[model samples]
Target: MTISRWKPNVTVAAVIEQNGKFLLIEEHTAQGLRLNTPAGHLDPGESPIEGCVRETLEETAHAFTPTALIGIYMARSSHRTGNKEDVTYMRFAFAGELGAREAGRALDEGIVRTVWMTADEIRASVSRHRSPLLLQCIEDYLAGKRYPLDLIHVDESVR
Candidate 1:
């Protein structure tokens, strides 16, 4: 007899700001068109904060400096690649500042475009969000949500 193994994917979220506007992406989702912050799976050997900054820069063409971790989210969903494979994700959402955009940098694949939207505009687009947490993250950010950078402690042994 044989058994299968499962692993929960680790992901990072970036809540980027510029002149009071939040950076977001419009993407295609199983639920329909939806908006989301620049986010993606964490690469091996990279800390959550590093992953967040990398993803934000890749998707938005702007540098990101995560100041606080707003919240962590977990969800199970089917793969969109027609395999319909079940997958679970551990997402680290962070609030941060957006630095200058890089010239000649292209947005990551699957991202349509990066746009700046106010909290109210984000609220109005609830129906278009890739996930329910899209609006929730924004609301939390607007609510002054914050957690110390030290909140996430990575044991040096893991490095």
Candidate 2:
């Protein structure tokens, strides 16, 4: 008998805040237009921190330097009410600084535009978020929760 291996999709996100507002992107999703942090899957041969930087640039057209790890989160996303097609995502959340946008850089394909929203605005629009973890990360950031980036290490094999 053969047993299939189950693995969660690993992703990285940037939690960038400035002047009491958080950076976010409005993007097209299968469910419709949705909001999310600058985030994406961890690509082959890249660490979570590197993936976070790359995703931020792709989504927001800005350079991001992650300084600390916020928290790791896992969420099960379902297309509908059924559990059969649910996908579990393990996200490595990081707090970072966003540099000025690159001139004339196109946003990621599905990204409509960038928006800075307050915590209350984000809380009120939970229905429009790509995943529930978005708010959790934001709230955690607001609460001053953080860890050193050294908590995660990438081996030379993946470098």
Candidate 3:
């Protein structure tokens, strides 16, 4: 039998903050309603930064300009109640500026609404988080950890 390589799903997230509140999205998960950062998978042919910007707009109805890399995280889930297989995700989280909302724009499927929460509020609701990374990203952002956006280089062939 041939050994198959394990591949982790790549995702991007935006840690948008203003006036001490961080922006988060409430969405329907197989487990039920959950909160997460404005995040999603990286699309084919797009860089992580580009994917982060796109996902932020799609999930929160606001434009996002990623300024710095917040952190890279890897997490694994073992047979979640409704999931048939174990899964791992590699996330590139960024800190960014969130712009004005797009008029009448609809959020991505499964997204119910966007809410701004203080760090205390987030800490209080850990049980409702979609993933631990949701709060870890925020904590990393609050601790003033950031890497230059140029840290990631996409090959010209991908353009």
Which segments of candidate 2 are over 4 A away from where they belong? 80-84
Model 3, range 1-159, lDDT digits (tens) per residue?
A: 999998999999999999999999999988899999999999999999999999999999999999999899999866567558688999999998989899999999999999999999999999999988998999999999999999999999997
Judged by TM-score relative to the true structure, which candidate is superior, 1 or 2? 2
Worst 10 residues of 1 by lDDT: 76-85
Could you estimate the TM-score for every candidate? 0.86, 0.95, 0.95
Report lDDT (CA) for all predictions: 0.84, 0.95, 0.94
| Candidate 1 clash figure, as a count | 1
Residue 99, model 2: lDDT of 93
Model 1 lDDT per residue over 56-156, tens place: 99988888999999998888766466566677878899998888889999988777888889888888888777766677777788888899989998777
Cα lDDT tens digits, model 2, 58-106, are: 9999999999999999999878633447799999999989998899999
Candidate rank order under lDDT: 2, 3, 1
Looking at model 2, the pairs that clash are none
On a 0 to 100 scale, what is the lDDT of residue 43 in model 3? Answer: 96
